[model samples]
Target: MNNKEKADEYFSKNKSKIKDSDRPVYHFTPDIGWMNDPNGFSYFNGEYHLFYQYNPYDIKWGPMHWGHAKTRDFVNWDRLPVALAPDDEIKGQCFSGTAITDNDKHILVYTVHSNDKEEQTVEIGDGVNYKAVSDKPVIGIDKLPKGFGGVDFRDPKIWKEDNVYYCIASAKNDRGFGSILLFESKDLLEWKYVGILFENDGKYGKMWECPDFFKLGNKYVLVISVMGMQARKRKYFNGHQVIYFVGTYDKSSYKFIPNGRGKTFDFGFDFYAPQSLYAGGRTLSVAWLHDWSNDLTLDGAKWCGQTTFPRELKLEGNDIYQMPAGELESHYKNKYHTSFILNRNKEYIDNDLNSRTARFDFDIENIDADKLTLFLAANDEYNSFIKINMKKKTLKFSRRFSGLCKDAIDERKIDIDICDGQLSLSVLVDRFSIEIFVNKGKEVLTSRIYTPLDANEIRFLADGKLKIDVSKNEIE
Candidate 1:
């Protein structure tokens, strides 16, 4: 079947298995299609609005459009009509962009694709960037930029500080180094080209997708997800990773002072395309929780893509730590189960599948082994599976689906390790993605995997010798 058909079939088979359809956990996949990039995240009039890159046409990847959804409490979401869809003149479709509220209007600046129509040739003009205005998106494709480089030059991130709007976009150079192009707008219409903020020096990767620029505390954080970067020292994959550079931004020169070097935000097998928004007094981040290299079972179930939990970011000394947002605790009303331990061994514990969603915690201290493995099953015996292995100082994950009658476990991995003192790991396993935070976001691992929802089994194993405390919280 085609991708649309496949997605429909997949959603039909597994929609019921999704956790808290009425109230969503920080981790869950789009019900029928694909979603990426957290957009238009703002709390206005006591409501939280979240827009994203969505392609409803397929369970797998395809032409992307702006998908809209909102929540009053950030837990129960109501899907709204798509904010932006590609009109005929646009070549392939809508590309990534950001949404900002200006005065009364919600101004959205996005890159529109005309690549397919404009043949790939130097002779052809660059692609176009447009402004999507919505008092209801009725006006449609309000304003566009003058030289667009096909669809490749897309994903606009917009922000305003003193009333003037600024945007940063991802562009590929002739030599293929991913770069960020800067622009300034007065009325959110006409944009003046500013100098390039940063570019890949063959250090990180080729293409930088979803570049988010924001201020945290007294420092600036430039977050970008890239594809095709080799590990300089430590990393699991040869392609696709998210890295960040924490520095100070000088608006006068429009340059950022490098505090040190760039590093991977999460040292896991999966985690890419992270976007941050300043909410309350803290800067909260949510990322697309899947990688290009791993299969999300979209082929079998047809639905795909997931978002990591809201992480509260803070600048600690010279490093940043990400912890689950405090608001997320509101979901713990039901409290199906909880576990705690000061010290332990092969402490294998299991809890009833009381609720569809859960928050699992492990406090680990004392390390003597070269490797450690923690497995979760629906039962105490055999079969049902979700395995997390810390081998050679790397964190790895694997799982088996309930529908697929395969004895072989499908391995979907994210590698991360702890530093200095004791390490605490929190895992949120929904229908699709597994969002793991190590040592309170020192290294996070977000991977999209498909497993039987009913397979509510959890197991813990240590390779050598270590002390671990475990707790599981089910959503009310």
Candidate 2:
């Protein structure tokens, strides 16, 4: 049997080995083994298809396969068969890529990592199965100009303009800096290299990966993940982080002029390789919600890693604001609401407001308060908490006391500004992770935590006075 067919068979046979309780209650974890980096996020066959980097052999990453799953709504997922496996090109493995749909055809453009070289490859399928368009790479090292390196060239994001297909890929120059290279194809078969779209200024990072280019609202935004960046104060806390540039792309000249400094969509420990697709008239995004430098998944947990809750991306001017997809609201149950004016140096704890699988949203107006803190998954001695300091204009999220990962990253902070002493915060807590949106998603933070499942206590504390409106929605 072929590699893809064999992978599907082995996955089906071995998936039953993992206990159902080992998986997250609401996030999509493949039936068995390790998964990372959401790929081929596209709307196909009237369903949202999200394929990811998979290695079904164990809960740790190994040789790569394209794992497939689909949903009519982003909340309910159905696992499909394994899509692509290592091809017979000197131990080649499939890496990150994107997908697009035209009529009845579903096309996948991905990177093939073989030997010491990385190249772009293509496949055609009808959502259930796929085959490579060519026996050889469609765009390879030869396509890059004089100064680019082949080792770091990967992650192609494609779009069609006036019947011509264009692609952007992440590559490194001879200076060891990352560059986003552009290419074009008449058909999907062969491609011609366009010039570099944007190059790193040596300050963003060493190598940039997972390039996604598209227009949002009135301007185009180019998103990429950076590697080898040291933490700079409150930004880029992880060794790798995701960032984007708001700019304009000139189709005639194949150039992108960035408006200002590069900005990040998230400021948390475990977010990388974000991919965004335009479907159903809105921009939807997902990313590998785990960091490579840290592996804190519980010991003997038969699976590892999941995508961040899918978010809807909206752009106003140059800033991109994201919130949980609207589809998530339909999956919530046990709705609870509470409103109270909390006095200075006081604590408020509610039994109905705490859950591992729930959503908490708070709207607060400062009444002589300098600090507001909300603790989640809390018991008397353990908890993960978010602290907002209006006096210092800062927000911090930490799981340091959650009784896991003593040596790994446990806290993240971001600078914030409260307008008119008003703040809107939304927190989504799954069994293993939490997402925080601030000021209607003008800023966001996402990370994974592994606390005791029974530590489901919610508490609010203030350093001074505050007016609060809060609600909890149990996610089913």
Candidate 3:
């Protein structure tokens, strides 16, 4: 049988084994096996297609294939057949890359990583069915630019500019530093090297994995996931983390001049390798919502890994703000609103505000408290809390007591400026993830939790009296 037939058979056999309790209601999780590094997030033929690194037979990472899903509004998703698989003759894995709509065909550009040679080769495919345009690499190791000699090249992100296609791929320099290489293609078949776009000066990390470059408003943004960086004094733990550089791109010279130091894309523990697509006149991005250090408890669960809710990227000054895609508001229902004042040393637990999937909007003013806390996914044994300190102007997410599977990186904190002594926040809670938007998305945090499925209580606490207006909406 062909690769498509094999994938269909494997998915059919294991799809029934997935535990319903472990799956997310709104987030995109594979029907079976393991998934990571969201690849090819793009819109083609009136549908949004999302592909990822997939292994169909197990809950752990293995032989890679491109798992596929499509959505019309970014809320409801349809899992399609697997798109790409490693050919028998390739003797390697199909790694991460991007997709684009070219000449009415879905073009997939990805890396064929061969562990035997410790090198990578680029390949492209056409149509929804990924038939390789060529069996050999269009751009190989011999074509790489100078100063880049490491074997860590992968994850090509492609975009079109004034009828010419540009590709930015992650690479490693001869000295083991992370870098991004630029390539230009006219017909999506042959590619020419266009100098190095940017590289780490030893301050970021050793190797970069996924690199995405795009224009948000007037400035150009480059997002990448860096590996082997230390976690000391950072919001994320030591391992793979995603960061973005806001800068200006000189299209004439193909040069990128960053404005300042790169900033953390998501001030959370579980976001990485985010890829964006231009849809509905906005840039929407999704990421792998699992961390590297967490232990997998997949003894009976047939599937693992999920993608974050699609976020709309907006640029305000040098900072990027992420809000849930506007289409997602259609899924919200059962709106509840309340206003209250919590005195010092008081804790309010709202048992009625129970939902495994919900959206919360909080407008807090008249601040007389040093600290304010909100608990979500709360139950008798598990709960995650978002703590905000007025004096320090910081927000911290703590999941230490949320459930089992304890790790040292269960908590993440970041400093933010509270605007006008008031806090406006929005929180989206899915089954296994929580996305917190603080001060109208000025600073956003995305976290993944393993709390119990029945943990649906909401609680509020304060150190002193404060007035707040809270609204909750259950998402269908």
> In model 2, what lDDT does residue 112 have?
93
TM-score of 2: 0.97
lDDT of model 1 at position 444:
68
The lDDT-based order of candidates, best leading, equals 2, 3, 1
lDDT of each: 0.61, 0.87, 0.82
The positional error of residue 411 in candidate 2, measured at the CA in angstroms, is 1.5
lDDT of 2 by residue, 1-476 (tens): 87777878887787777876766767777667888899999999789999999988778898988899999877679989888889675258999899999779999999999768999998899999888888888998999999986998999998888899999999999999999999999898889998889899898888998988988988999998999876777866547888888999887788899998788879877789999989888998999988887878678777887998889999878889999888888888999999999888778987878788888899989999999998888998788899999888899999898777546888888998698889999988888888889988889988888888888988889988899999898988
Q: State how far residue 386 of model 3 sits from its true place (Å).
A: 0.9
Residues 44-160, model 1: lDDT tens digits? 445566667777656677776666666755556766656555554334456666665555455566666564421110001011122333222111222223333433566678889
Best by TM-score: 2
lDDT of 3 by residue, 33-56 (tens): 889889989888788999999998
Off by over 4 Å in 1: 1-28, 89-92, 116-151, 299-302, 334-347, 350-356, 367-371, 377-394, 398-421, 463-467
Clashing pairs in 2: none
Q: Which ten residues in a row have the lowest lDDT in candidate 1?
A: 119-128
> Could you tell me the lDDT of residue 60 within candidate 3?
90
Q: Which candidate is the best by lDDT?
A: 2
Better of 1 and 3 by TM-score: 3
Q: Predict model 2's lDDT versus the native.
A: 0.87
TM-score list, all predictions: 0.79, 0.97, 0.96
